[model samples]
Target: MSVQKPADPESEWLRQARAGDTSAFDQLVKPFRRRLHTHCYRMLGSPFDADDALQETLLAAWRGLGSFEARSSPGTWLTSIATRICLRMIAKRPRRLTSGDRAAPLRSTAELGEPVEGAVWLEPLPDGELADDDDPAAILLRRESIGLGFVAMLQQLPGLQRAVLLLREVLGYSAAETADMLGTSVASANSALQRSRQTMRARTDIGEKKPVDPQGLERLLQAFVAAWESRDIAAMVELLSDDVRFTMPPLPAWFDGRAFVGQFFAERVFQTPWRLEPLRGNGQPGFACYIRQAGDDRFRPGGVVLLSFAGGRISAIDSFIDPVVCRRFGMRDEIG
Candidate 1:
């Protein structure tokens, strides 16, 4: 079929887009962009990878417009294209393994490893990107879907199996549709889905965190920010659960238990006077942490700290040491 397949009821913009109209192409893809990006993020477990995959998918869709058969809906078609792009990306890159489980005890920050060079760790998505709409209440995605805990669990599955589980389970696609997207038979898709579900069940805690009060969220965030900036290890320790997890990506150490973590912070973290800028990430409260040394004129970007909450307590803190993640939070390089 030519680009001029006008009767293709799927995308009015598709017909114009096929006829070399750039605006029509923009119209055709804008509706799917955010969702497509999220899909890629789910499959790949990194926002940067998702951005690259989405761009590649759109480029592929643009070039392949002449082959657009309107048998499937536009969203499905875009999803099919995007999923394949992520699959290819996954094939080419090394998946960032979570080292928290295998990590040596984090006795001190002196032992923290250098950034593993490339994307060698699971990264987070800004919760702001979860929904296309500005009003968060209107968004339909579950907290579990975008949570770092869940995304890290997703990283353990094989790429296609991950795609199958995401498509069939999370995205609400039928087995047949998921199979089509994966270029596999329905039986294979269902088998993969079963295996993925079993693996996830065995490896990860699948319970979703219950919703918290917005005012409570903000209050806790403000308190945590104050506590952090004050460099009061005691105050910061009070905000954490007894079993809270502290993980810094690209560094192979994770500390568990409030007393150990509290002691670690008191001895290591509080040594540097910090300036924290509050932010949001992975649908949770986050901070852009800056450190001021004795002679430092301004506080420089040290890391991005992401906090996950459960039952009115901070349950987890993922501090990304990678500078790219810091930039993704859209903060200035230094705080004066």
Candidate 2:
């Protein structure tokens, strides 16, 4: 007697999805959501923009499913759609930039110029939002790809070059696969990758250096948290690199050098009582800051700060102080 064979899960989902089963479509695409969201964030450099692009990609996928030839896996197909959507978004919107990227550092922290309008600053992705991939290589890839420094450098590249570099180097797509996704020839994709690498090298030491030891990084972060919570500006200064940078984005002002950053912290940042809840984001150590206002006992959400390390010291402190940013990071409005 012949026995019936079980249906392939992907094939079954594809059939249901094509037949307009929204649940099936959701299930079919669930496995790729986190990676695709990360891809969008890497391409756009803003979590909000990434959210929009991912929604657009999913909508496009739903409408175009009938044309999906199944030549590649669903993930590959979704990624192609996402890449195109991001390219369009990139063309229309201004490239996101860090405060340091906008202009020279300010000499004083007396006044943080009003939040810069019409500019999109790079945003951080909460580590919790990342995929639950246990593979060592996948973890490494996410670490290298989603770091704020790397994403900022990627923003400097033209759209095609950025896409090529991400697809080929970070995502591990073959040259031919990248070309097919971007609708170009393999030679062109290779050329874009070469140019992208050159630009990235010119901007920062992205792939050349080794990461600081985890134990040391933990110690540094712990010291920073203690100093910050205790309002010990001097102690905080001790953990900064000689050329440390302090930037509070949306505020056009940034400070360079440990002396200047320390002064800013003492005079501007620690003027109010504060508490920090340690967290990680953008492949770096950070925290959610809650501030106690004058005459108020309750601590309210203040901001999110992500730190970059160099030579066992804090090299850069990128703070997002907007209430909206705080909310997006899922910090409670009141931490008391």
Candidate 3:
């Protein structure tokens, strides 16, 4: 009897890729890219950083493919590599506050138009990125996790804690699985998960979970744009909830409630002639604010503002004035 050898799984494709078959490698990697990016984003909290880490992870996976035994699925292997890369990056970076950490406290509707400053701005994830068909629950979980508050809370944890919490809670990895990914004891992983949960619970009002109505949100946002463009202070004030919160980050100050917002806008923001160019942002309503140069009516890009709505009213307004942030949001120096 002759003994026949079994064909190697992935051997054909591997050979093709090794021979510079770009298409084959792309085919193998295409499906995982978005999910990998989402994972990296959760770990890093910065889309830019996630892109960088993803590049590194893919390159590492490609280079190390020879040793990738089929013991684990390709997705699992990629996730493990990406997780390690993010962990290393996080360890090197200085700790900063998450967007939620700096979220302005809720205020009454009368404070709606305040010109508050000095909070680190939190940008929203693109709607397309958040709307996943494969896993609805996971998508919602991811959205909530990426909220300014959640990101801020994440920043409070140590690098490893952040990774563990993201893996266990956000990604739904079990304790043993996370232990394997992070190369820690299961007990250590569990401990990190517990600590992360406790910190998040302590910092945020977890019980205040409110559902966002997308259509209603859009209506409120459209009204805001119309009012602001028309400089209708009354209209703008009318759209704000009684306890709307206004904060702009990288500055420490924030204004709570509508009266301060009204005072700030009436006294300062509306004092200047400005134009707003509408833009979609953070899966919600947004605008590019432009200031009309003195003696001229033409509006030059001033900054970007992204609105967050809660309970049918604008609750949080994130203003990004940094030139770098403007570039990231795909805004030009001038919008005509």
Candidate 4:
């Protein structure tokens, strides 16, 4: 009987993976998979798209492992690859904002407990995926990079603009470095960066360098939820500024001002057996609304709602009823 010697894990694994050892390659890539998926999600905006892109990235990595050269860290290299993949996908499917794409118009308070189809909801990232220990700056940057408004605005930019903004602003890469990674001249990279910045400035109210107060935002959300759940219309009204606006994506209708919003809740949502389950969505406060089904003890998740606040009042409300989004937000089927 011939005995085979045990292989040195790192060297042997890398060698075998480079030489087309599937299991060895899986072992090499397993540790970074979740982080890669999170990165893709931040770039792509949809969990389904992120998952597909992650798979494509791993396949590309596996096939191109021999050419990896190790000039950059494996994680950085993988990020570049994933970013390119997302850029390609986004270019092919350009996201457009139409007058009818708002989310609020399609849902009513009474429909919160009923199952609704084709409702678009923002999905939440798992808390485990957000672990960061070393640099507080990096942690905060990651959170800011994934905010819903940020992501939505990112979708509006050209593919290269999106990539440049992410690489330069979010990942802290210099123009020359990003140029090298993208195989472009530094001049072109700088041009892209300037254009990206201009586009962002014109398209989004959120600035590139502003810091987000996640805890303070959470407290405000809690207050909003408490007011809504308690059926305190006056308190809810207090939370809304005079110019507050509410919009739900994938639905065309939105309401502006306190009077319309007040009428909305009073006529539409009040006195329903509804509960808000806390969720972290788009790197901000989110709630899963479980509405009691008629004659059924089980509460179904009507939809996942995301809130945007400004000037101490709720500025926007995005209600997404897509079932896939519900699952992505970690909403349980049976709510207690």
Candidate 5:
């Protein structure tokens, strides 16, 4: 697709990149890399998968550098490549399973089943891996796009529809642009978007999300860390919404309502002494939980706990048992 030269701003970098300069390639790709990585993550629902896709996209972009025509801006071009990569990946793999897939609701610890091996649970993205907090997109990023729940809901759609919705809605691509990227007619792109929107709206509880006060959440999280470390069940209960949900993914078991959630914590979670190191996950407050077992004095890696807020209380607790997630949060096993 040889075409007109790129815009003047990109011309020099494009020239350098095409002239066998790796530095120029880095200059061309670095600015869009994080957002593209995030786009991959949202598309795949697994950070690890996203990493692979992003790497492949960068490599492809590097190899195909000279063929670039300015049909789209650099960022869009890179993202389109990443999106297509993720679509191909999704077709080759199993869809990510969330707690909603369970056949029955788990009410107690005994009902907790074994972790489903090979089940792809939606992995949380670190806030650092996301766009800047001050970016206009960051406002929507928190309550809508980057939330674990939203990402989980996106999994309901087929890869193409998911890509359509994200490109049209989240990334603000026009219908024509989206269609071009997906290699579909505009009508089909619009149709897929309409259907995906309806499905997503029905599947996601966006209404329950309130504007998060950054300062308020930080203070609340501080108290939360204290209560958790102290094993103060009452303190923890005081901060929980009456209808809170607790889900430990890959286990396919979850409990609803504050009472049951609290009971699960009191009976099972707090039985072990824990030390939580605060971290941010999916643009929300979370922690890397460490446990000191009965026979072991050294605190061992338990799992990472990601919390979601609603109505001025803790609404959801998404505890990921994946050691991969722990490493993502930069936590080590056996914290001394």
Candidate 6:
């Protein structure tokens, strides 16, 4: 007796979704959602922007479902839609900025300029929002790509170059596949990939340091947190690498070098009492800082600080002081 072939669930879902079934569309796109969201995050470098782009991608997918030929997997088609949406969005807005991109390092923190108005800063990705892959290796790769440094490196590229790099390198699409996704020739896609690779190499030193040691990192974070809570500038400075950088987004002022960063903490940051709650995002350790204002007994939300490591020492401290940033990380309103 001949055995019956197993039915393809994706094909079934696609059929239902095309016939105006919103629930079926959700089910059809559910498996590809997280990765596509990450792709948007990587493309746009802002969670808010990614959220907007993903919504548009799904809506477009639902509206245009009938036009989707079965030439590629459903996930690939979804990604194509998302990519085109991001390209249009990129064209409409100014590129997102990190503190490093705005101005040179300031020697003194006495005059930190006000938050630049109407500029979209690069936001951190909470670990919970990342891929829920079962494979350890896949998880690691995702972590590496979604790290702030990698995303910042991507921002250095032109929109087309960035899309080509992400599709070809991160998503593991072939050159021809990337070309199809971006509506370009295979030759142009390959050229953009080459140029993006070269630009990434020259722009950042993300992988130059030795891998961070987890045990060592744990000890370092504990010590730093304790020092921060106690307002011990010296203790905190001891944990920093000599060339450590301190960047507070929204405020263009950034400090570089251990001595300068330590001075800024002593002169400015430690003036107010702070309570830190540990958190992790973008595959790095961070804190949600609550500041106690003068005459206020309760500590209120201050900012979120994310750290980067090099040679097992703290290399960069990014303190996102925007209210939107604090809200994104689920910062509480007040705590005593």
Winning candidate number (lDDT): 2
RMSD of each: 3.7, 1.4, 5.0, 5.1, 3.8, 1.4
lDDT of 3 at 157: 79
Q: What is model 3's C-alpha RMSD?
A: 5.0
* TM of each candidate vs. truth: 0.90, 0.97, 0.80, 0.82, 0.91, 0.96
RMSD of 4: 5.1
Full-model lDDT, candidate 4 = 0.71
lDDT of 2 at 234: 83
Q: Residue by residue across 36-69, what tens digits does model 6's lDDT show?
A: 9999999999888999999999999888998999
Question: What are the Cα lDDT values of the candidates?
Answer: 0.81, 0.89, 0.69, 0.71, 0.84, 0.89
lDDT of 4 by residue, 56-128 (tens): 9998998889898877867778888888898888777645342224344333433433332231333445444
Q: Whole-model lDDT, candidate 5?
A: 0.84
Model 6: lDDT to the true structure: 0.89
- Ranking the candidates on TM-score from highest down gives 2, 6, 5, 1, 4, 3
lDDT of 5 by residue, 1-336 (tens): 989865664667778889998887888888898889888888888888888999999999998887778678998888888889999999999888778665455677776888876647888888878866576666665447878888888888999999999999888999999998888899999999999988986774733456558788888899889998999999999999988888887788888888898898898889989999988877677899999999897998888898888888888888987777788888886788
lDDT of 3 by residue, 1-336 (tens): 999886554556656666677777777777788788877776776666778999999999888877777576677788889999998988887555433354554333334344433222334444445435557776566657766556656767788899998888877788888898889999999998888888887884421267557676667777887887778889988887776655554444456677766655666677777777677544345787887766865677667786766666777666766555566667666654
Residue-wise C-alpha lDDT for candidate 1, range 1-336, written one tens digit per residue: 668645643367888899999888998888899999999998898998899999999999999988978788888999999999888888999876665644666655556665556677888787778755655544536466777888888888898889998898777899988988788999999999899989988984533347667898888888898888888787888898877778877767778778878877877778888888877777667888998888989998888888877778887778986788888887688888
Clashes found in each candidate (C-alpha, N, C closer than 3 A): 0, 0, 27, 8, 0, 0
Rank by lDDT (best first): 2, 6, 5, 1, 4, 3
Total clashes in model 6, counting residue pairs 3 or more apart in sequence or in different chains: 0
